[model samples]
Target chain A: MADTESLLTTPLDSLHRSLGARMVPFAGYAMPVQYPAGILAEHLHTRAQAGLFDVSHMGQAEILGDGAAAALERVTPADVQGLKPGRQRYGLLTTEAGGIFDDFMVANLGDRLFLVANASRKAEDFALIAAALPAGVTLQPLPDRALLALQGPGAAAALGGLAPALTALSFMGVAAAEIAGVPVLASRSGYTGEDGWEISCPAEQAETLAKTLLAQPGVAPAGLGARDSLRLEAGLCLYGSDIDETTSPVEAALIWTLGKRRRMAWDFPGAERVREELANGPQRLRVGLKPEGRQPARGHTPIHAPGGAQIGEITSGGFGPSLGGPMAMGYVAREHAADGTALELLVRGKPLPARVAPMPFIPHRYAR
Target chain B: MSELRFTKDHEWVRADGDAATIGITDHAQNALGDVVFVELPEVGREVTAGEAIAVVESVKAASDVYAPIAGTITEVNSALTEDPGLINREPTGEGWFFKIEPKDPAEIAALLDDAAYAAFVESLA
Candidate 1:
């Protein structure tokens, strides 16, 4: 962790403080981990209603010039050129060896391709993308913008109250609209596996916009703690915790994000490893785990077969507030990745009974 | 009921004759929000002062509950296995983690009293 004094503050930093948030250093930014409501309440609130999150720490940028989508395809396995305007797609930048560089959301906003990358990897992601670009293409970093995610069952209703036109967008749909009289780009998608919008606006208008969203019925402030638990429950992967430079798309169970055409073309970086894994099957696979007991098996906990050798290790594990129990996701040998395959999680030197379970412990409520 | 004594680690010990009821202080519970699991020490196990005797888990992370004074565990709280939130709801009462028969009751006097513990908690902020 970096020194607190040297950490950057988001546009909503003062607002988070005013809301009684517990500020923590995350990805070199002073972000709120939770507020007075705590993680459990905030998580339940989002499930039942809506949560407003300050995701301004994430990097937002645009790709400009002709053949931008094709240029992006050189690095990522996603079918960027096939993405139509007014829509978005999840993409992964792959290392030469097929490991994931970073996972990001790329939206076609008609004139240019918009991207949102993880905060920790933004600098690296931008530089990598910029260096890979053709002489005619350009990468534009949007440092003057702030992003917010309004997510939950009630999210659409609350945001719809401000800009009714946004309600028309389906899941993964992107549109440019004036939300609360502020020009913004919003997508009908979120990491929480809920019906919501990821809205991007000018940095200066972020506070007013956040307050406006909070003023809407059933919308309350949530912090990174809730956001993390929510995503975990949704079976989504956290970049640093679940997937990293060494985890390939196949092993991470992100085969769907590997565009069909790209797989056929086999032209992206690290294509050989992905192709080999696709045909021969990955040695280890990311799977969900449900501990029979209440104690959570946190990240790095060794995983083993019953009365057998160590197979893999837990990547991310914690209490899933929605499930009202402990849930986890980890990589295990392909033989033990099936749902209901009994396993043991070595927690605190004790082997705890657990079983491989299907992900999205709770059903997703995305507005598709 | 005897007045509660405290340790700098935020554990409280309520001494009653040779037996003492132990639990985390309210300040500690507030710091560790939304307790989800409590791993209690086994009865009859001998513990030394400042030793980690139990584990308390919240949604975010797990913390060790240290022994305030040396003692032998006489009984453990079984209710916490089912409802760990008792630690947050009643840190000093129903949330008691265990009862220990002290090796030396006089050791309780060296721990912080209520007012001193309160001041110590304030200084942390």
Candidate 2:
């Protein structure tokens, strides 16, 4: 409700157009789906070398107050109080009924907690935080800043050359520094499941930072098409697409993200239901499914058991360009979540043979 | 060789006696960007005018190629199995999807001629 449909623009819009990118409406922004290099090449490029992505449309903000962490604790179950400076954690916002509203990343900067959330859910997330926080804590949205992701094995080297301090930050770590003389708040985390960095800087300085990063030897401008495929390869969940109000973290196999302290205290939103589900496993869980053929199941494909009984539906499905096969991720009955369980995905009315497989069908190569 | 004609759906056919070689227009292929997969119609299949006969999937999206006229499939372009990108590279040559024996050659006459197809392409741009 907070002006979510307003079609935001990133600093690199002109650059994407100049590179002959096919722009499409995504998360209320005119983002490039693919470029002339095609998605396959871009997918492979991100896994091998560094790929620069304009993630400016994502929500980046700062939480301020003496009890900011305590106030945020009401909505999110994550133990923000225990977070030390420079460390970050993956957390989720939930409704009172225990449905996941959105999954986000939170990092403790020196005096404030920095949070980055999905673009489409930003307005709702901010409103929820504002409504939950006490008078002392103020929700500060960083309107003048944009975010960029540099992902791949070579990202560290490319970024380190620009700012030597970047190389010192470990995985899930944050640091404030200058890249090529432009100030930035960068974190050693990204969605690609590779060792990478997410750089946040003022909108006016974004163009210079992007140009400097793209000028690196191994860095190339990657579009959203490759980003989706790459994240799928990494076995990361995409909010709104992979999980929504109807899905719970436990059912999504994301219960591990809930802190042990938070679970025991049950102070977060929907804690009773979440705790009950944890005690007795959720009725369903998200699992990786690999089909036998080249034709992908894509989203909304019906998943069935041996007798053509509908058991679940595919949430995110596509051809894994890097894995060289068709892959999908969907929810199935908890009893059927085990790997190697044979299933069928009804594609275009004909059932295709598929088997439950452990995810990242391509194993993640994170730097740890 | 009777003549080459085009359907409004962007399919081109070169009528030879009662048979025709069916392929997409150069303009259609260019618009498709990069061809990644081609679903060809099987030989001996029957199709009605304007009915979808085959599918052409590019890197971005999938498109159905309609039958230019009522016809029976005679032969298919097997070359696409090894190299589907040929459609993007050469929409009128090795990229042809299949050949058909037309049930009514008069339907071909009603299709767009080269000049008309050229004008249609220009109008689209």
Candidate 3:
């Protein structure tokens, strides 16, 4: 962990503190990991109602150039060229060697492409994209902006008044709107497997926007701890932990993000291995593990076949508050990736029986 | 004559003659956030002072519950298996992990009392 003194602070820094949040050093920022309500309550609340999260530490940027989309397509596997204005698509910046450098969201904002990449990889992503740009393309990082996510079944009800138009946006829809008179780029999307909106606004007005949303019925301030459990139950990948430079998209079961046209063109970085693996199937694939016991098989725990031979390793694991049981995701040999295949996770040097289960342990409640 | 004592590791020992009831301190449970599971030592298992005797898992991470003083396990808290959140709700009461027959009840005097344990928890902050 980086020294807290040197960590960056978001516009909601004082608000989080005032709300009695437990501050932790995360991705070079002094961010709240959980509020006084606690992670379990926050996770359960979001599933049942609404939860607000301060995600300002993530890198926000805009790509400007007549051929910006085409240029971006060269670095990422997602179909940037086909991304229509006011719509967002999940993206992956893959390495030449077929491993994922980072996963991000690319939204077409009419004149430019709005990008939100992981904060831990923001600096590296900017440099990578900048260096790959063809002549005339420019990338601008929005250091002066802050991002917040209002998520859950009750999200629309809570945010309808603040940003009237936001409640109508479909999943993955993006629009520029005013909330409490503050201009914001609100998107109908979130990491949690629930209906929600991610609102990007100028840093100066973030606190007001957050407070306005929190004042709504059923809206409560949540932090990173609940965020992690929510995403895990959603079966979404967490960069660096669940997916990284050493893992390929095919292996991570994220081949769906690869554009159909791009698959034929095979022109993006790492396209060869990605294409081959997509056709032939990877030797190992990421799968969800339902551990038989309550003890969570956390990251780096060795996974094995019934006979005690190592098959793979757990990348992310924890207690699923919604499921009321311990669940995990990890890479297992293709043979063991089939749902219901019996596997064992070595926790505390003891092999605990686990079974490969279909992901999204809890069904996603995203609004279509 | 039962008395409460604490260890540097944040476990509490309620000594009554040669037997003691043990549980993690409120301070420890608070630091651990939501307790999801508790793995207790089996009854009749002998454990040395400061040894890792049980395990407590929270949403964030799993932690070892150490023996505050040398003792033999006499009874384990079966209630925690069904409801581990008891640790967070009542760390000093219903959340007690197990009972042990201490090898030396005299060692209770060596552990921190209420005032000293409060100061110890303050030092951490």
Chain A TM-score relative to the true structure, per candidate = 0.99, 0.97, 0.99
Question: Using lDDT as the measure, which candidate wins?
Answer: 1
lDDT of 2 by residue, A171-237 (tens): 8889999998899999899998888999999988888899999999899888888898888878889
- The regions of model 3 sitting more than 4 angstroms off are none
lDDT of 3 by residue, A117-155 (tens): 999999999999999899899999999999999999999
DockQ of each: 0.83, 0.38, 0.81
Report lDDT per candidate.
0.94, 0.86, 0.93
Candidate with best DockQ: 1
lDDT of 2 at A317: 85
TM-score between candidate 1 and the true structure: 0.98
Answer with 2 or 3, whichever has the higher lDDT: 3
- Fnat values, candidates in order: 0.67, 0.08, 0.62
**Alpha-carbon runs more than 4 Å astray in model 1:** none
Q: Candidate 1 vs candidate 2: which has greater TM-score?
A: 1
For candidate 2, the per-residue lDDT at A247 reads 85
